[model samples]
Target: MELPIDHFRLLGVSPATDGQTVLRTLQQRLDRAPDQGFTHETLQARADLLRNSADLLSDDRHRTAYEAELTALSAEGEGGQSAIPALEIPNSKEVGGLLLLLEAGQAQEAFEKASRGLQPPQAPALGSSREADLALLAGLACQGAAEDYRQQRRYEAAARVLQQGLQLLQRMGQQPEQRRRLDLALEALLPYRVLDLLSRDLSASLERNEGLQLLEQLVRRRGGLEGESDAAFPASEFQPFFKQIRQFLTAQEQVDLFSRWAEAGSPLADFLASIALTASGFAQRKPERLQAAYGRLAGSGQAGVEPFLACQLLLLGQIEPAQALFEQGADPALRQWANEQGEEPLAGLCAYCRDWLEREVLPGFRDIEADPDLEAWFADRDVQAYVEQQDRKRARSAPLHPPEAAAGAGAGTPSTQSSLDAMPLWPGDPLASGLAAPSQPGQSGALSEPLQPEEDEDDWPDLALGWPNLHWQDLQLAERWAQLRTSAAELLAQPPSWVLPLAVAVTLGGVGVGGWLALRPKPERGQPIPVLPAPDGTVQTGAKPSPAATGAPKAAASPGAGAPGAPAPTPAPPAPRNLPLTVAKPSSAQLRSLLEAWLAAKAAVLAGATPEHPLEQLARSALVGNVESQRRENASRGESETVTAEVRDFSVTSQTPQRIEAEVTLRYSDARKDANGKLIASTPEGERRNTYVFARDGQTWHLAAFRASR
Candidate 1:
């Protein structure tokens, strides 16, 4: 019987290859076949075909005869005009019609037809490599669209496009090679997406937490900084990225997050511990944190340690020596920073260093909790908003021109079914950067008739993955650095008296407020800051309310570590009615009382106080379990918080006879103290939207499941 896919092509070996090589190749393929997410029948069929091909190719006499048949089959196949000569094209006009459009360089039309064909009624029209080919076409179409989004800096949209394609391909897992192609393209977005998240404004704790969580997930998947050597999309350098993002987070927040990671001995232990110590040293004005940081980096010889050490030295107001050390390193960012200093030297670099640590250094690192009124100040002159608005317009724009209409050299050329076959795969940048391989004679459409790919040792091209498919870029990182430097220069121009011993006046610290609220809708603040209703039922706008009025256990009264300027507030959630909720009028007072009681209990526990009488009875076992976990964590860290939970805007969405679903705006103010009872960190507030499923046990309502919004 004639082979459906030629044995040499299936094994991806030259016809002159020997039996030993064929067997070795077959074994390798069989080993990898199981993990490709193929269907059971497909796997079985593939296994049989692979074994048969190897058997037929192994014997010298049989191989000679097989090669003869393959040569004759090739001649017949060429007359048929099929690109993938190894595999028979399925007898379906639906598939043939789409392939023709793809060959014509109309990727969008090919993709649309393929998409419609994949639906229930049309999927039956496809089989074998042709089915996989259709899926590959759809994936490549997504890649083309994503590359456009990347150039426009619409990172989220680009990610969405890739993710949507991945979802579709994942469901059709029979074709492993095609699915793998899309996977690699999506992975390329890791750095760009993470950078965007880090650079975005810190408007809400929930938003910040979500970004941090997403970033961490990506890092963990890539095996963090240390283990990404073999990763398809290796992690971006974190030390400098962290340094850039740290300005948005408070010292307490930094310590709270990083210190926990360090203490837990996470994969990111050493670096995170160093950051925690650095932030703590400034927060507490304790030299011990610096000593520890020095110990962590001094002999570790980790990448970027020099820059980190230089930063520590700069923090100590060691100007000349630190500058020398910074310039010594191969860090592009530091070198550029030094060069920019020549333009506006900022009192000869001391101004920038002084602004960073004037409020630090020496002693008296008391938590003054200055807010800087960035909300009002940034609002008055929202330059970032204008720039971002322009960016949004650009992101939503149509392509500058249709796909490049070049031919000979094949730069930025699209390979559709109707188009000529591409040259052997280029080992350069994947499809996204429009980096074309050295052009050869024949070509095929990238998203439509991708078949008979050249499995080049350096670059795998089984499908016609055309230009404008990969989305990797420096992503204006240098531009961001320049912007920061410019901002620092402007800050130094004003505030002449900020120098205290080191000319450091702390331009922006502890608060990770990003460039602009208007860059994306996620961080925009359109509404007035929601006011928490006083525990006694009245709204508390200015003065700190009594324990009863603030929904705290009266016994845990402590000084409110207030902000110097008005506190930065989180936006309240949409009113309950605007949400798709089953609105029911439940006793508002009853829900409030239940929530306050739970908060009082929680605060008491964080303060290292015994849970008030009936604390166990006050909440459901699940809620109690979460509280106990928090208590144990704080205790392990030798720290505790005197927390005051102020709940407001409680809206009951849907309620059952045994339970109630509600959303409330909660502002949690904590004066975190170490085991010594000394106030080491007082962040003033951490607020988020709290969703509660208040499950009632017996007659009384109890806190059951609670989720803080991301």
Candidate 2:
């Protein structure tokens, strides 16, 4: 007979047993599986189950209670009494329709319909067929329901249903499909569960107390059995799911997991060993362990070879090698060349390395290179000096760095400076002149190699990347930006008032033509506008109306209409007059106040300290400043800044809530110098651009963009 479904029984133990005992027993079973007629599927499945169950038992409460109960059961009876639970296999045809219907997302309805229309069972009297099928159907139905719930983001309900389904599937050992379905359901549910817990638990975990403890517990519980596969089920079908689990492991505190898996020589032992070694090296900052971990990956011949190779180079701190591999592997030559020219090539490699180190290596390490404790472990004085010098040099030359590179008293000392300037191609060479041994015959090329290029940011070294120095490119870019700035200033010098009205008329003409076609009547029923009405007294339809008949109103006879009922035409109404505007000229005191307000606004935007939204505050303050400055100028005060006293000939044509139009003339004398009080240029040379604008809010106006006159 097949083994019972109870994990304890399968392991030849009672429920009261501890995880350690259970684990040992399971290992022994795995070791002898080949000789015991266990298929690969069965063996792997059982191993996964054992590993997962042992992990579950690691909790203090669970372990304690489970062991106590198992011990009591052991004391009660032996052999047949404590049988491992056997899974009931459902007949293929029996649950076939149910499975398909459940797959279609109609599980509950399908189950109810099948139950109500059940046919009498043809099974033996040993067990009730109706009961067995119902149990099986109920389990499948719950899993299907859970999937629906998960899709709708009802995660808590999904988790509950999934947990129940998994339990039921465990009892339905006879049905492989049921087992498979349950595994898939759990795989899908686990990610959402982990994410939800993380959102709530991340802050607590950051704290030093029980906060991190709770997060760790939730991570283990949610992410632990993620990669476990059902033996009776096809695990390969869920490769993407397994990949996701592996990703989650990188983000959590997984040392305990790695150690346990390594000790057990589990199928994941290779990966775990790598994580363990790399983590230790990273935490300790020991390069050897880091190198060793990478070496292990090289031997694996796995598909994720890029990450492994990258890890080794990164740990060794050989950026160029890793960069070469990444470029060659991830892109075409043209794209790769372009990428190299940009910052992305090196940056991408570095980001990838950082992420891997963060995940698999010492999850706790921060600033791995500078950690003094790690540095002290390397006993070689020369290597230490070499590494330190290289780091300092790198810190100096690294692009886009903050001012930290230029700080520190000995930051640019000769010893450190040379290492930072080492040629990328000469990675193995010491920064100091440690010459190579004399070359043999036919090795003259090596001996005659030219001295390295001068250590200047603009100069190229022997390496290909260093050859096309980025400094020249940056200088070119700066020059282009300067030219653009000058062009923009010239453009802004021209006034907008003259350009806007003509552009508006042109735009309106186009709109009018388009509107005419849409608004005018179209020829319908093969009838078109005729030149005149027919000769008869009757007016023919479809004729264009004459000017007099086009709503112009008929003229009256000499004095008045002869008809007694006729009334004189009402006098035509006159068009409304536009409101006049008032303009102000700014003086020194007003100018100072306006500039002060504007400067404050600008400073606030930069500091992010402004009470109002930065841009809104900027616009409002600018308007106030402009209005105040206009007022000051109109008062004929002394020339201020670039603005001077002029013949304040200004006029306002219109002033409505939605529209404003104005004209002004401005002139100024030489203003005072800058804060240093030097002699300033004469003539008020600043240009003033006038604009008529439609306003949304009565107090604020946004300039509708218009083209400049050619």
Candidate 3:
């Protein structure tokens, strides 16, 4: 008879058990067989099965052979994948459906389905071989799904799913290898999960603290919290990764985090604490913090901090020393370019440092959208902000701006000049605030590449994106921007080399249109000739003049210069009144109210409800078409969403009396669910920056156009 159970399962013992324990366990089971209420025949058969498994496992040769077979089967069950895949299990309707979903590249859907199937009353029995296949399938689905989430930067969800999967597998207990893999995956996700928590909104203190605790645990394994390397994390990536996450915290938070590390009294702690101080200095524009940062670096016992120290010096207006250190690090080609800009050597030096400096050395606070709550919180602090016209009025003052790019050490350093004349302190911006790397279409928030080796040095470098939009400086920023625009337009204007024949056709078509206008026959004199205006802004004339032509009916003598019986000329359309407009506070409030009501209606529409407002009142004209298409697309995927929308940065960029052109950042969040109430998609938060136009009648504005910024 073919027994479906493996030796481990049959014996109810782990592979780790010794041979003596295996045999003793079998003997003990046999002695207690009658307690199971089995008849003599059944008892004997049970004894035989237990004894047979024990005998095979008791011998080293038989145990090794059996394990080899099990390994081969395990590999086959796990799809023999180097990268994780859904476990290849014995076919059943549920398992087959799950696998098919995975095969179709719908990992989230597969994950949801598998999660539901593996829980509660739906979960299969644990004893049989068939049930074990389902168990392994559940583990595989969790792993594969978590991997997909990790790739999408959803580290929190990935770690949670992996942890749950690991616990589930431990309860199932047959596959040691599957359990180990799940544990490893969970371990790998810990650091990313911590990063995600730290990078989120600062108000989430509970989550951030949890991340900190996890971080402390990670360090403890390396040696302790003050160790130079990490156990789970790579040593090489330690500095840059920590530096990136530091920028996402406020100055107060940085100081607090550093204080914790400073108490540890190790070189690693000193280095980490120094990083916090440097970031805090920039965040609060505090000279004391910058000096403290430099002092802490001495205790760090770290090497290669010359560049960072140099930047600190520049910010403090130690121009001569800063300039020397900066130039020493410059590559040969860059040095040549710097030497070439002799007229304004400072400008070129600043551009090179700003563009070419490694991001690891750039330290600052979180760059979050302005919020009323955060503003209120910042206001009560003793710290001085950078935006005020006078820095001396504040309790905290500093040489906020950087030193001049090239140093004469006279009165012209950035730190000595008025804030407006120089760059704003770091809180204002490392470069300039509003003009910082203004996004062009398709280039939003992306860092452009540095100039190619063969590129002309005199031309604007792609890396110097902020230079073009930076209007206040004496730099010809606007002109450079125009040059780039003109260059792009010229490239787009030219026809493809292969499309010469199409160009020929376009030329012929132009000629044909002109010829048609010239060669057309003139209307007969008495055949109801229509009145028309002359191209030279005069009334049309016929060989026979009308009574109105001599100004008898002055208004009627305008365009309709033919006989008085001719049909009234179309009244001259009023001259288009196009002028730029600034959206006022009252208009802003009105539009915001309208948008909120519109979004509520849209949610109903997406959920398959036809509201009484009929979408026209909610989003008429141009918005209606966009709403309808979006609804249809979601519906095709068996999806629906209940969205909450908020608009920001609202402005009326331009307008006519009848039409208002505006732009806004639409912030919304939604969890999209299918017909079965299963989540198909989710965005905790999203922002859509775009411009739209509205047509106005009397009081109501009709949406005329809706489009994204890029």
Maximum-TM-score candidate: 3
What TM-score does candidate 2 reach?
Answer: 0.23
Tens digits of per-residue lDDT, candidate 2, 379-446, equal 33443333343343342332221122323324332222222233232223333233333333332122
lDDT of 3 by residue, 1-710 (tens): 12234666666678999899998888776676433122343345456656777898999999999888788777877895543223223234444445434434556566566666667777767575445655655666778889988999999988888887777667667557777888888878777887898887768989888887776666555554324555556544554455456556665665666567556654445554565566555445565676567656633434434444545544443344455655654444334434422223343343333321112223345642221121222232232222221222110111222234224434443323322333332233433222333323332222243222233334534424643222222233233233323322332122111100000011111132112112222212111111221111112234523312211110101112223353332333333211211233226445544444555556667667774355576444334554676689888987776655455456666554544556665554556788899987665544455555455534455444444443
TM-score of each: 0.29, 0.23, 0.32
The ten-residue window of minimal lDDT in model 1 covers: 511-520
Clashes found in each candidate (C-alpha, N, C closer than 3 A): 31, 23, 0
Model 3 C-alpha lDDT versus the unseen true structure:
0.48
lDDT of 1: 0.47
Off by over 4 Å in 1: 1-113, 125-132, 201-210, 225-257, 266-710
- Model 2 off-target regions past 4 Å? 1-126, 148-160, 172-177, 190-194, 197-200, 203-710
lDDT winner between 1 and 2, please give it: 1
Q: After superposition, how far is residue 666 of candidate 2 from its true place, in Å?
A: 21
lDDT of residue 306 for candidate 3: 40
lDDT of each: 0.47, 0.38, 0.48
Candidate 3: TM-score? 0.32
Give one digit per residue, the lDDT tens place, for model 1 in 483-508: 43453444343322211112111111
